[model samples]
Target: MGANPRGCLRACSLAVRSCLRSFIDEAGVPPAFIVGLSGGADSLALALTVIDVASRAGIEVVTLTVDHGLRTGSAHEARRVADLAASLGARALVETVRVDGRGGPEASARDARLAALRFLALREGAPVLLGHTMDDQAETVLLRLARGSGPSSLRAIAPIRRDEDGVTWLRPLLGLRRADTAGACAQAALTPVEDPTNAIDGPWRAADGSALRRSAVRHSVIPALASALGVDPVPALARTAALCAADDDALSEWASGLLAVSCEASPAAGEGSLALVVSEVSGAPRAVRARALREVASRAGIRLLSGVHVDALDDLIVAWRGQGPIPLPGGRATRVGRGTQARILFEARSPEPTRDGG
Candidate 1:
């Protein structure tokens, strides 16, 4: 893994082939694969490689480019990706989505993009594929760490995600590097567009440098860490994510059982909302208690919870004295009891509930 570009590209090609084949072997054969392409090097390389391999397995491949329409050339970029995907023997499709302005453009765009991809998977009966690399995983872990996240947040972006519709989204390039993706694309004589958002610095960077957290981590934080530590920190961060993911899985499983016993088993606060016995929560271990609170809030549609939120909710249980209520974002709140009941009621925000979270 030297700085030799061509060698990296060759290694990346082999790695992508292995990961994709393994996914197909484990998940069984799919009628087709819907790859979420962005005209970026990582996705372009993945699309081309999967196209070649899936065709050999008698499986069809289709590429969907999400035109976010956030930037000036975004639609053109999608068109370019669709054209390249078509040239690579994969059917190409394009869709436009309106990104909400909340939670920053990146997060809002991501949620919108995933919604579109999930829709495609359900409607077309195929799993969606993403081209997230190890670098992306590293950045995610770093971001979560900064936010004082728990073990689950440190788990970072998962390699595979299965939605409610039973559609599985795959990230075959999770183990690969960003540099290698570009290298691989170069090797095959395919030109990939450089997404302005992915640019680390210079003119491409936003005037407000901190506007995009991912970009800042990718360009500033990562480079600073590498310079200070005298080594590449991305791989170590990614490895930490893998270890944390396993731990999160175990904790979540245990917490699920604890929640079942502790919860009132009734949606007393309305749909997508539930109540938990205060005594049961107080009697549980801090970790399990935190998890139970996490579970309840997650069910109540709070997706972007941090350790701060978890501790605050736990305080309502273990550290309770006379605190009336604890505040949860998205217009939700938690109170110790209502009327004669000694249980905590978790409520959803607004008329309809948001279906997000673990």
Candidate 2:
């Protein structure tokens, strides 16, 4: 906290603007950015910070509050957030999204939100901004750990990145704790509504949060870790994620370079896929080989490539005896070849012809 609310707000604003300026300097300034407002303290603080910074920089920006229709009061919250943006002389709108029953309610809601934001960003030719703080990063890492995810799972909440839709996503508050956002909101005299789902009172989990699976991890698991550690563990967990992200980034770069030299666009019956040269992949280090295979899967829009899939691809190159297609997500797979002339192709399986019941 600061001596007063204004001082605290100013400090928070500085933290955010500094990060944004550095990101723009490195990644090249986009035409503008669209901030996602949820009426929560984090997002309210972000909306304020972004408007102030963009105003100073003379950048045209907009705010969007996605109403997922998952809860009763969501529309009201969106309206409030929009009004806040308007008060600051910024353009804001509420984008309603239909949550499809996929994965679960929580996952579905997330997908819907991302889809809405990405749609807006692409339509406006600008990047999307989020207000994910260090606490969110910690919760994600903990959830991934519980799920037995790999190093990639540990790379939680990237500070900034471009998604598959070619829309850039920025999270300027990841370096700040969740408390800082609340402080920022307080400083700016912004009383954002408390999201009941995020409230964790004592050891008893809120009944309302049951539908949001992440709340379990955020409320229970994270607090348990902090209690056992005898101090707050969020910053530590976030730092670990940062380190993992750096390693993942380096490996991805290496794999990208390898793909340029050792892979080719497969002429396989078109899903627009890639092929890895057997000789090249077989000779490369395991790390480079595994990452290259993942890059191949990602390019084919198969992001659910598991370690088993990667290992199966490895077997194709090192222990090939003409294995059948190793299954991947999105109806895609990797098929092995016999020799140095063979190209391990990442291809989508053709749909089986349907028989008429008549």
Candidate 3:
């Protein structure tokens, strides 16, 4: 806690050991091998720490570095990470991939990186590990808050997520900070690369600055609130997020039972190409209705959704006077006409019947 890199490294090692052991025991994920490596401090530290932990547990470790090919020195940096990982006692591999940075540069790089990791995991038959830290989550929440997002968005990111491709992605360092990750990497004698893009000011710069701001909010703002308002805002907000997640989970389960899955975006939709049917989304509770509509929109491949969009869908459910249809953010809605069976058929811009080809 004192900004000591060695201490942070030790703590990170302990955390990695605990998470890997627990995941093996509970999630049935094999411990013999884990995949993830980059020249970045967070990932390098994670790879080194995982090797130390897994070796003690009689498990083998492998490191995979995905060169996004976005920068000039990316491939060379990947090789350095591989060499360092090998010295750390992991069987290291590197794969360079072409990425266009489409659909927003950061997101596209993330997609390409994750796709490479998933491929590596499947090929190696192992779970892939990531180095997203708690600081990252806090920053994400702060960014979402600035964008006027909802509770789930404010919850930031999940520690674990599984893809339909059977890839289990784990973030064992969610409770650690970026500064701590750097400290750990230094203690491990691993020199991490500083991606110039990370420090550069651009549209994505706020994404990084948000974390610094969030730390201030957590360490400074919340305590100020506690002193002035006689309450800790951090704990209160965290508890609210937990409650919202619980309610959201329940709503999702209920909606799953009530609504039928018509189509899901395979490659996923980015713009207004997504759509869901009213037949499957109607007659549910407001919570369930919101979730169903969002899922449809998501299946249509939209990533960022606004609260207003959900509210508009809610209004459609209740105050819908069948006057054609209202305009949605990602797409337009049309009532089309009365159905043969007296049901109102609602369709979005792309129409409904497109299936996800995953």
Candidate 4:
């Protein structure tokens, strides 16, 4: 709609075009692609660029604005975003989700939003595009690091992820900074909705009056680090995430291969039961072994397997001293043999019988 300053709009358009072209080359062109628009600068810029790119390719763009219903006037904000999308010649939908607050408010809202996006993407057989920027990536890595996360956890916010249910999630803007998106929005003569919760000292706060974790990182920690080092820390932190992602990918591949060779499902033990060759697993490095064990536990129908559970399982392999059955989330792991024939058995615990028979 207007001239781009410093080519921010052009850069975003090029990035979207490249990502769409790559996906098309792999799976052929779809009728449409879905965009998660929140009326924010980042999503607005993404919507503009994607609309431009899809127009050229004769593809339709559908934007979904989710209202989490966490605050007042959320429905109005959703309508505003949908109106903008409709004005730009794209189909718009507003999804209202209830945040159960199972996790913290922030996390629960995200989960609800993602679930809505995934449902729409599946129904339309399209890819879902998000507006996560390099700044978001840096914040994610910093937050995970503060939690003492390992390499796999540190490889945060993948640019492209394909879920098990065949939903493709794409974040083409991860290479661009937050400022670039804001500039792009300005270039397009679009005024973005400023959500107060994103502000450093906004209305959202913890019980102790501290800002939200991400907001605090974005406004305070990142700037403080930059001031201390006399350099922008975002690029370096983003680079670290990229490096960790590469390493994690390699290790994951290796772990898969190791599992294929050293693990087997026991038919006699029924479903959700597997056995791992203790010697083969113990011979591998700790990093690869840890991943393999996690995979094994997942296959055994164990959900939410924590580090403590994994470590205890690992000890059964390396630090074995005739320990008893180690209980897991949904099952138990026990060593069944000794010497070279040792096998770690992961079996789902049988459901207990009801007191009153049906």
Candidate 5:
């Protein structure tokens, strides 16, 4: 295993082959040729492992590294990542992106990184591989809990997500720990760059609190749980996430059925509108109501709404009877009136003149 990267690759391949095969077999989607390389241990290991798999499966490989330019030496780091990818026999693409802290630095950087990866995938006409590991999942769950979020938050990050655009995001290393990846890099004699941001005291540090809790989840929680329960906590949590994902899929499908008729109307009319009699929508199952509101907001390109906002929309939907509009985030909503008709208005684009509009 130390001499041959194939050994570590084989281990990962066995663990993830079923997951990968299912996506391809059922969805008729092939393994994507694009791998995201951040020059970090996790992503480097992922690229090496992916190259090994591609060698066996006879697939082309393209590596993409995004330079966010947030710190000095970022460009050099991206170049190094590209070189490593090329050494591993992947066609490397280096993309330099500007990060505007519109949503704060970290969030903006993440959004930009994802957008870059998605752009690469679109241009290449393939799915994109992300290098999220088991530790990231645990961290996400803890962060969500800290924020007083719901059980759905416990489900945390996903292993795979297919968007409406047919581009698939795959996380093949979600089953591996960060330690395992670091060990693999050492064994492979790979010098993966360490991102300074991971160690800095910023929003991530503030959220995790003192770096001790963050390290505990990495070093303590899984081991303590294994000691007491006789099994790895991460694997167990991954399974729980899988079940939750399935449940979410079912709920989403049910919501789609409920929305089919109302959404089939002209996009302008029903794009963000739901037309059941006010009585019907109000009395619909709670899950159904939440799903419908989420779908509508989604169609209208509004994603800032939180769980509380969704709940409020549900309440409003059930209580409405007259023509006045039900308020929603991003200045969009459904106006319900007499009879069965409802108008979905993009308040941002509505021609109604403002006090200052001349």
Candidate 6:
């Protein structure tokens, strides 16, 4: 921590300005942008820094605080965040969303929050900024590592990403640590809201009553690992994620080129169906082939393909042995034809009807 609070604040401001400058250089500055402010230390610091940077650039900043309505006092907190943003010379709004408990509370809340943010961004025709720090990236890599995730999953969070809906999400704090944000907030005299869900011993838990995976990782696993190693593991893990991201980008580009040559629309199969020429795909290395397979499935509207699904799909290419159609979540894959004429078809499944007639 810097001895002078103003110096710490200035350092954070410079870091944020650098990130914004990079985006401006690539995409040009938008007339305005939306920042997701949760009133937490990370977001509070980001909002303050962004407000300062944008003010100097004459760019409008709108801070949006989403109230997930999962816990008591959330609405009040949202309002408080908005008030702080207004005081900082930026427009602020509170978006209230209902979490339907799909996929689990954590996942569901995230989906809801993002949905709201995307909606507002689309309406305003602006990009969305978020406050995800290096510590968060470390936790994500650690969690995915325990699950035996692939390169894509282990890449963790990208510093900037454009959603399929044409909304660009920017994370300016990815290079900064969690402690940096907290210190910055203190320097600026901002009192951030403490989220109970982030507590390891908080009420939020899995169905089995264990602590939430991220909270446990943040409070227990990282500390224990640091103690055992006699060094802080966050920067090293975050560096690993950055390296994985670069490798994944290269692999993705290669896979995309292969897909362009091998994949085509299959009108005979069904609407929005895709056909992959087996001869063209089978020649590629398995790593590239797996990526191409996943891309084909994703284009066919299957978003959640596990490693098992990709392996089974790969079988349709190199391990073909007269296997039948493999059923997937939203579609099915089948091998057709023979030799040079062989093609793998992905088609959407028709929805099953309810027992009661419409």
The TM-score between candidate 2 and the true structure equals 0.84
The global C-alpha lDDT for each of the candidates, from Candidate 1 onward, is 0.79, 0.78, 0.67, 0.90, 0.69, 0.90
lDDT of 4: 0.90
RMSD of each: 5.5, 4.1, 7.3, 2.0, 4.8, 2.7
RMSD of 2: 4.1
TM-scores of the candidates are: 0.81, 0.84, 0.70, 0.95, 0.77, 0.92
Which residue runs does candidate 3 get wrong by more than 4 Å? 1-6, 29-32, 200-244, 257-285, 295-312, 325-358
lDDT of 1 by residue, 98-194 (tens): 9875676677788899889899899888888888999999999999999887787899988888877898988888898988888888788888887
Give candidate 1's error at residue 150 in angstroms. 1.3
Per-residue C-alpha lDDT of model 3 across residues 286-310, encoded as one tens digit per residue? 7777777676655554435567767
Q: What is the lDDT of residue 214 in candidate 1?
A: 80
After superposition, which runs of candidate 2 have C-alpha atoms over 4 Å from their true positions? Answer: 1-7, 23-31, 200-211, 265-274, 297-303, 325-343, 351-358
Q: Can you rank all candidates by lDDT, best first?
A: 4, 6, 1, 2, 5, 3
CA lDDT, candidate 3, residue 334: 41
Least accurate 10 contiguous residues by lDDT in model 2:
202-211
Ranking according to TM-score, highest score first: 4, 6, 2, 1, 5, 3
Writing each residue's lDDT as its tens digit, candidate 6 over 1-358 gives 2333366576677777888898899998787878999999999999999888888789999999999999988899899899999999888999999999988899999999999999989988888889999999999999999999778989999988999899999998899888888988887788999999999988779889999999999999999999999999999999999899888889899999999999999998888999999989898988899999999998987668888898999999999999999888889999999989999999888677888954
Q: What local lDDT does model 5 show for residue 188?
A: 78
The predicted structure with the larger lDDT, 1 or 6, is 6
